[model samples]
Target: MTEPLFKQIAALIEDSIVDGTLGIDQRAPSTNELATFHRINPATARKGIALLIKNGVLYKRRGIGMFVSAQASAIIQERRVAAFAATYVAPLIDESILLGFSRTDIHALLDQVAESRGLYE
Candidate 1:
């Protein structure tokens, strides 16, 4: 299933923050800019920005613009980690159990997979 447009916009901003494309105190793209760039409605783009503000990933600067919060990247990273566990890890565990894999077996398999991907360092 596809994610909603607003959520996709939100994820785009989150990725920018996490990847250092956006820095703390830096202004985010305005609603107009976002709408233009993504070919989305201004309202839809605003909804996405609103999500970030509500989550403390962004803050308004009165008359200036929305800026990345000082801790935005860290917060985004934490949220993504939790989301990954829920979205992928839990399902993997459930499927492993259904396949008669023991906890140890799952752990070893995960280790092997990580090693193959050079992610086990």
Candidate 2:
């Protein structure tokens, strides 16, 4: 199953931040703008934006829309690491163990894969 729409919306904003499409200290798109762009409800867009604000990835200006926080990129990177570990590493470890692979075996397999992908120097 896919993530909830709000989470997807939040991820989209975080992705923009990570990719430098939305720079820190820049005004974020309004809730209505996001709603229109994604064809989602205003409440859904608001919830997504609110999540970022609550997590210190964004800040709201009085009478103005939200702005990207100075720490937005770092916050998004931290979230991405946690998401990666949960979504990929945990499952991979579990499946590897189920397949009778030891910790060292898993490490070696991952190293081999990384080398094959030219990720290792």
Candidate 3:
């Protein structure tokens, strides 16, 4: 599925930081660079970066520029993992029971997934 422009941009920048394209203590691109690269408004770019900052994924360096937080990638991963559990697991479990699938059925499906994905040993 395609992501929205701002979200795509945010993910790209975040991934860059995590993968060392943007290092610790290194500054992120200015809003203008982001705007030009992504063909978006500077305001939009700023808002996207602001979202990361709000989530503790980035931090300002005042007179310098934005830097990846030491814990930024870990924080982002944790948030995403929690969101995934909420979005996928809780509802799936509720629906499975409502549709008469028991815990055994769920465990069986999980085992199938694990085996199919080579996660089972």
Candidate that scores best on TM-score: 1
Compare candidates 1 and 2 on TM-score and give the better one.
1
C-alpha TM-scores of all predictions: 0.90, 0.84, 0.78
Per model, state how many residue pairs clash.
0, 0, 0
Predictions: Cα RMSD each:
1.6, 2.1, 2.7
Task: Score candidate 2 by TM-score against the native.
Answer: 0.84
Model 3, residue 111: what's the lDDT?
93
Output the TM-score of candidate 3.
Answer: 0.78
Give me the candidate number with maximum lDDT.
Answer: 1
Q: Taking the tens digit of each residue's C-alpha lDDT, what string does model 2 give over 1-121?
A: 9989988998898889999999989988899999999999999999999999999999999898899999999988987899899999999988998899998999899899999999977
Q: Give the winner by lDDT: 1 or 2.
A: 1
Candidate 2 structure lDDT: 0.92
- Ordered by lDDT, highest first, the candidates read 1, 2, 3
lDDT of 1 by residue, 1-121 (tens): 9999999999999999988999999999999999999999999999999999999999999999899999898888899999999999999989998999998999899899999999967
lDDT, each prediction:
0.94, 0.92, 0.85
Deviation from native of the Cα of residue 17 in model 1, angstroms: 0.3
Q: Estimate candidate 2's RMSD in Å.
A: 2.1
The per-residue C-alpha lDDT of model 2 at residue 118 equals: 96
Candidate 2's displacement at residue 83, Å, is 2.3
